[model samples]
Target: MSMLPSARLLIVDDEEDMLRLLKRSLTADLNCEIEAVPDAVSALTLLESSRFDVALADVRMPGMDGMEFLERTKTAHPELTVVMMTAYGSIDLAVQAIKQGAYDFITKPFEHDKLVHLLGKAFERTRLIHENLLLQKRVREQESFQEMVGTSPKIRKIFETIKIISNTDVTVLITGESGTGKDLAARAIHRLSQRDQGPFVAVNCPNLPENILESELFGYKKGAFTHAAQDRRGLFREAEGGTIYLDEIGDISPTLQTKLLRVLQDKEIRPLGQTKSVKVDVRIIASTNRDLAAKIQDQTFREDLFYRLNVLSLQMPSLRERPEDIPLLIQHFLEKYSKEFGKPLKRASDEVIQIFLSHPWRGNVRELENLVSRAVLMSPGEVIREEDLDWPIRETEECLVPAEVSFLPYKEAKAQVLEKFNREYVSRVLMRNNNNVTKAAKECGLERQALQQVMRRYAIRNKELLSNEDAE
Candidate 1:
């Protein structure tokens, strides 16, 4: 009989006869691939080396008893389904095994049909779990925009705009708060553009001094400066026939701006300490978090250069403006860091997710990514709880009404405070109850209709909370 490809089983028992019987019975009856191990240690080694749909381990083993093995297995591979077997099974022992995350507990003297039935259920659970994971992956793919992940209308519009702009050779200016992935947007443009085969050189304008920044943008001769040991190909030359991304462009000095404007206009660059200007062909993409318009008025930024860079512009929305994308972003980061750190995938607990949804992500997407990366390393279990997060304590201590809010009219100030409180309160209750409105309403001591009205008033979305299965 052909075994089901996806349903692979591992049977761990100390007795050689038991192992043979299990391997033969499971393979024939369930039509599943079976690997029988003589001991729990061998089973764990197999688990570390390969994937299995379910693991059946005996509670009574020679060394590293079944209970201890189960604990270690769950710690390392929390997604693996496990079922405990014991000849001396008691109600207390069964409950203990269940508490330790066993999919099921079976007495060793059980009939063949009963064992098959229990394993069948365990395999089904594994199948469903795998299917759910694939579904989540498909959902994330649908919601993503190149390297950026978001399903919100604002982000979707940004994706559309980027696609439209990628077809053109005109200069583009990307404006957004710091850490909002302006660099990613620039790269996306270059990747989709005609110069996809050419180099993409990125320069952080604010990180270098004025003299250094100029030379870095345009190549310099061997004797250009004291430290110039040899002829250098600057970022412009390095990015020939491609795109040169100037990050934090508003921070560049006026002298640099004048030089940059010349390059944009002339389509050439004069190397440092060189009399002749070298002809170049490259696209310019600039990004800034600062207010270039205000700087132009203050004479710090050149208005002419602004016009050159702003031929096409994109404004990336902040994390706060697109709060609906937070969950998807969290999922994205969790998947990223878990694989990088070699840790079993972990999902944020309902409480932790509530905190994430409420916190003002001042650092934007980068900040959230850092937080998730740390959580992946710190969390010991399958779920990332409040303790795993960096700022849950600070989140709990935040003021409902800001000091600036007190300056408003008394009625308005009070209304704002009440609105904020209701939003936070209702959202937390819904998250705890997996967004079941009736259950959350009961927990909040409000009628279902009244709670629904409050949700409508505050624009709270039922879709914001993680479902129980999703959280796991």
Candidate 2:
């Protein structure tokens, strides 16, 4: 027997004769086990007692109707496949059933082959859905940390880094562009660390003034300052035997950096206007988008504090660097928002997905998630089509097909097009720099040799190309 034929089935109908007819129709062709129930209540009872591969129910039953029965069945046993059989089939009902999680529907007096074909597909989809759920559950349970979903090598490297640093108590410095989920990474480390149960206190250092920031971090005695009305415990005290995440650490003043360095070095905190220092054991996780090395060179950031926080550093890749992860991320966001909004969004259209992959997500995962949420709310139905998505045309244009093209032979045309682009790009860079290769290389994110190679290939060697006006 085929896999579909071997699947367990449960048939539900108000009439005993109809139940019998379904049993006979399926049992004759299927090489599997079958159960027949007279009403929705009995069908539900059977479902609770024993698992079935598929459930087929009549729409107009005596008690609970097919729609209600399907909803209850799906809620109770989401892994089971459900197909509704209705004499009165309309577009509204079909769409409603599908939205309520029905696998498929069959009309009354259905042909034998059509019934079999629909059932086969239902079983297959059910099997796949169940398998994916099992795998996802296994990953969640075994990994202990949330699955950082991406197959890109850059993301893989980040995973490796997380795994390596998770077991240690070293201060982790996560440097990434804003909205890159630095906070999530910090939590993942805590989850994988020995201090998993301890409190994780996050403080954004840049959002507060110097006095308030210090007071919030170190706490204050009653009347310590104008607004210090009572004795207060600081974040360092609250984070005892736990972790304290200092976000935007680079934005803190040099004076505060000195005070912070003392906390790292001595593992003690002195509350504002307090005479004594309180000893506290805490792991520090700091994140920033600024280049701390440059800040240190400029004397804006203290070198001593920089070294303390740099013990373990992780650089998060920009969204553009890992375009391959866009599809997975999009699906993740879609499912999340669909569930949140209580809507049944099946899938994003291929064109919409392609647009997402092609766009430069400067704001990273956060931006992508917002875009998906917006689209889900605006989408009229289950499917999210291309028109449902809103993309910035300028950002997409860089990665999408160019607007203008010249006709040429297949191979030669392509070469000529590439040459023209290279020449134009090189000329622009040279004009911007007045023909200075070093400055142009920095602007283009290319090495001097690489820029020269492009120049040579395009056959553009005008010394004037290096002149300031030409570069501009």
Provide the lDDT at 355 for model 1.
Answer: 85
Candidate 2 per-residue C-alpha lDDT over 1-472 given as tens digits, one digit per residue, 9 for 90 to 100: 2355357999888888888787888876765688998888989999888979988887778879888999899899988989988785464686689889988888887898899888877778767877798899875454323546666788878877998998999898999876577888888888889998999999988667898999999998999889788999999999998899999898888889999999999999999889999998999999987888888899999999999999999998888888888887877788888999998955888888877787766567766777788889889978888777654423423522244544555787677677767876677556445467755664465656788788877777865654632543
lDDT of 1 by residue, 251-361 (tens): 788888999999999999999989999988999999988888888899989999999899999999999999999998999899899999999888998898888899887
- Deviation (Å) of 48 in candidate 2: 6.2
List CA RMSD, all candidates. 14.6, 13.0
Estimate every model's Cα lDDT from 0 to 1: 0.85, 0.81
Query: Whole-model lDDT, candidate 2?
Result: 0.81
What residue runs in model 2 are displaced by over 4 Å at the alpha carbon?
A: 1-75, 81-132, 135-147, 381-391, 396-472
Instruction: Compute each candidate's TM-score over C-alphas.
Output: 0.62, 0.63
> What is the lDDT, from 0 to 100, of the residue 317 in candidate 2?
89
Candidate 1: where are CA atoms >4 Å away?
1-5, 88-94, 135-151, 163-170, 176-181, 187-200, 206-209, 238-243, 250-268, 275-283, 289-311, 318-472
